[model samples]
Target chain A: MLLKLLIFPGFLFLFLCALFFDWVDRRMLARFQGRVGPPWYQPVADLIKLLAKEDILPTGVNPLTAAVLPMVSLAAVLTAGLYIPFGAFSTASFEGDLIVVLFLLSIPALAYFLAGWISTGVYSVLGGSRALLQYFSYEVPFLMALAGPAILAGSWSITHIVDYQSQTIWIALMQPLGFVLAIIGLIGKLKRDPLDIPKAKSEVVAGSLTEFSGRKLALWHLTMNMQTVVGIFLLVNLFMGQSSVFGPIPAFLSFGLKSVGILLLLSTASALYARLRIDQLATLGWRVLAPLALVQILVATWIGG
Target chain B: MASPLRSLAYLLPQLWRALKEGPHTVKYPFDPVELPAGYRGRVIIRAENCRGCSMCVRDCPAFALELEREGRDAYRLIYHPERCAYCGQCELSCNFDAISLSNEFVPGKPDRKDLGVVLVNKEG
Candidate 1:
């Protein structure tokens, strides 16, 4: 109990920072709209309210699966978060690699799919299907882009990737194609806006989260925010160095802020755009992005080789 | 397949607009939103024509309007703006036609007390 309590503050801090980024993104977008914007501390207020709200379980749903969905996603994320090399917070050297982190990121989607299907609704099933399909469409290009740095660094370890960037020029300059592809992949992973076909508000009514209310909705919502932070971290650590020293402050805060910028670009861009039809996303990925990524990889290797 | 690409092609203009245009999403608190036609805003009331007869108070389903005493014929109209359901029922049945809903649905309130619109009829 004591040990867990001690760990509590650290966990709270990570989550709070994650929530902070989400709030900042929203507020920034609100700023773009010429609004006063949410208070900087809005995410904290939202989470506190959520925690206090009662958890509503689905009636006669697979209790085990329903219980497990958020747990598995949260566990995988927290585990992956361990490997994420922020300035001072990144601790473990190599309990996992880039591939492992990438794969673990998918666990949330698995939990999401199960959550959708177990809810016993048509929209849930369709949404779950769309989610899985989205997984396949985007994961390939994303991995290839992720592999862009690995190709140069010649290692799968995220630390190695970051340390490699720290040694060399940032990967964004060397691999613009990879960077763009990776960002698109990141957007897909976050399931925001155009790629939010799974829970497309037009069709599925929050899709997987259709039946969830109160605290369950809140947990999923919070996790959604955390996922954006994680996605941004992966982008930063892979393409932008998290540990490079700056004037007085370690560049971790820079990572945090820039991640918010990328997320801001996403959320605003999303508000204006409509969701892509499922088939379009598939064809776009397979026909366009896959080829682009494969060629970039071939070219990067050739130039570097 | 064809349509999405087409849609993507169509969306290019919007992207171009975003790139070329200034920030169109007007800042909220510091800068106010431009209320276009059919702008759903808080209800505003004209104080004079309203008779002390409480049709608006009775007609309001959301209980957003209040007929309070300010002075003789100066009935204090406290409009709890947040309590407004935007149902427009209060706007419809104003027999004196003293009240009208504006397009300015800002939802701004420092507290529940601040949400009210207080007006009194004067014999001007």
Candidate 2:
């Protein structure tokens, strides 16, 4: 159990996957923009460099909150990682654990909000408010989108969802609207551009991250990347069918390829679109995505029954 | 709303083409760059043809050039890269054709001493 948690399908595995996935996203985005991206080791290099830098605490900021929030976020993501099945194995999972995973997934954003709120900078405050606003905007539809698969599989367990998909067809095909909505929600959840209003560089200077530097910032970045991996893992399992279609090796390959494909699609979207305004984001997430998610749930229910 | 959908349709094909084309960035440092014609870079001095003329020193907007007398009509031409704007004014001001710009754009040194170029006129 210790080995499983420390290594495969847990902290180390998920951490590496997060870094690699981030590299893939960056590389694909660079290719889309007709530029050579950083080398494969760039993420590792960035982490090391950030670690080597001096941690600067801004005035009026609670040092404990500033230092601890990133670790809390990282812990949330790593804990969520244990619930997400990798290839054919999950480090930790139980019946109705999907709800737990869903809750865990939001903790990082909450951490960001707290980190921002505890900071003295006006930009951090603005970023914190925006983060809260973004949380409200996307969380509902994201859960609703997840509901499509949960309903279709008749189980709230991720393993069962994958099992159901492997026996029949991927949920993505069965609930196409839900899949699309889920992907959109995933983009917003990950804070990618077009949905990255909180940390809009031009406006808020990294939003909630404006005050963090050195190791704290590195941990925060790692948390964000791990969230990306977790998000992609959830999407793949819920929609791309079970990874163990053939065997362990084939499962790993297919899972990797599908993850890359999804990452590329995300990178493409991020590259193509500009950042949405806070108002536009709210409208899109609530006015558009919420209704779409509802319709998908209705359709999924009818078809599932 | 429809416009965004329309633009997405337009964007998909372009994105596909871009992906197929692969990355457009040049592998700089590892691979040599093909600098465009008339590209102005670091200035080089031709000490043999130089007559210790200070026109370059006077005309330099960045004050990057200095001519120190080493002997009678002999001078040491010092180029300080820290101050150089790479505007090629020094290269243009040399009537003796003593200085010209090279296409090497990599400012590779961290130390200012490594960046400074000194040329001494031997037959002044």
Candidate 3:
């Protein structure tokens, strides 16, 4: 009970903060396109409404799966946040290797895949398969891209990575290839547009979420939104780690501002590009992105290592 | 192979031109490209030309027009932006040329209740 108490608030805080980031993302994208976006409170309002809405289950959906799937996704994402070193504070830390973070980060998609499959809906089955493939395609490039940063700081631990960045030039400068690839990979993992094949609205109806509605649907949607925030947070920590001095207002605003910039970049891409198909996405990852990322690793290792 | 090589040689300038040219991506958030003129967007209505005729009311694909008639003859119009598909059908059907599809896309809602676009009679 006590441990649950400890975990709950942290997860809640992360979820709420993630939603704020999503709102900022929409706002920036709106500004980018010369349109006024939803207000910052929009995400909160949306979640509230979605939670209050009727939960609709498709025929043959396992009630247990429906109830547990979203919670698991949310739990996994928040758990990673516990481990992730944001600026300086990591709720849990060990030797600072992102190996743990990488595995933990995979939880969201894994949960999404399981949810998609267990729903026993055709749309979800297709979505689940696509999702599995999608994660498979991007994880390699993401790992390779991250390897450059690890090489620079001589550590896989993100705190050390951040600390190392402050000491030297930001690793982004030394390993531009790695930085760019990582950003691309970040976009991929977030399942944002141009790589949003799994959740492709045009192809799969809500992709993995076609059968979900009401509170359960709300939780699932909420998890994805939070994952977006986490994705942006990870990117910020890696490339633009903590630019503000410590204080509630200033630290909050600065962190918020850094995240908004990332969100803006993400949303802009989302607005401009159409999503690639599953096979094309895979090909892009393995054939194109992998080679390009490999070049970065080669260069970073040769030069920095 | 020779034919392909010839084709490559012939296409060398094009390849060189592409290499010399810049990236295709718009430098967004900095250099926002212009939205096309006919881009489907929010609908705005000119109250002056908007006669009391209920043609647009019936013709709107979203059934977006709700005429709130006042003072027996005087009237008010409510346009639901959320429901309005921006299909340009309303603009096309409006004989008085009252409605236009503007590029301004409003996405936020202060309240779900604030759904209607109110057209109050400001005319003297």
- i-RMS for every candidate (Å) is 5.2, 1.3, 12.7
> Can you write out model 1's per-residue Cα lDDT over A6-44, one digit (the tens) per residue?
242235545876778777767655554444457878887
RMSD of 2: 2.7
Q: Candidate 2 recovers what fraction of true contacts?
A: 0.70
What is each predicted model's overall lDDT from 0 to 1?
Answer: 0.75, 0.86, 0.75
Candidate 3 docks at the CAPRI level of: incorrect
Tens-place lDDT per residue, model 3, A263-292, is 776776676566788888889889988999
Worst 10 residues of 3 chain A by lDDT: A1-10
What candidate 1 gets wrong by more than 4 Å, as runs, is: A1-10, A242-248, B1-124
Give the interface-residue alpha carbon RMSD of model 3.
12.7
Which candidate comes out best when scored by lDDT?
Answer: 2
C-alpha lDDT (0 to 100) for residue A232 of candidate 2: 91
Per-residue alpha-carbon lDDT of model 2 for A61-165, expressed as tens digits? 888878888988899888888998877888777888889988999998888888889988999989988998998998889999999999999999999999998
Which residue pairs collide, candidate 3?
A96-A157
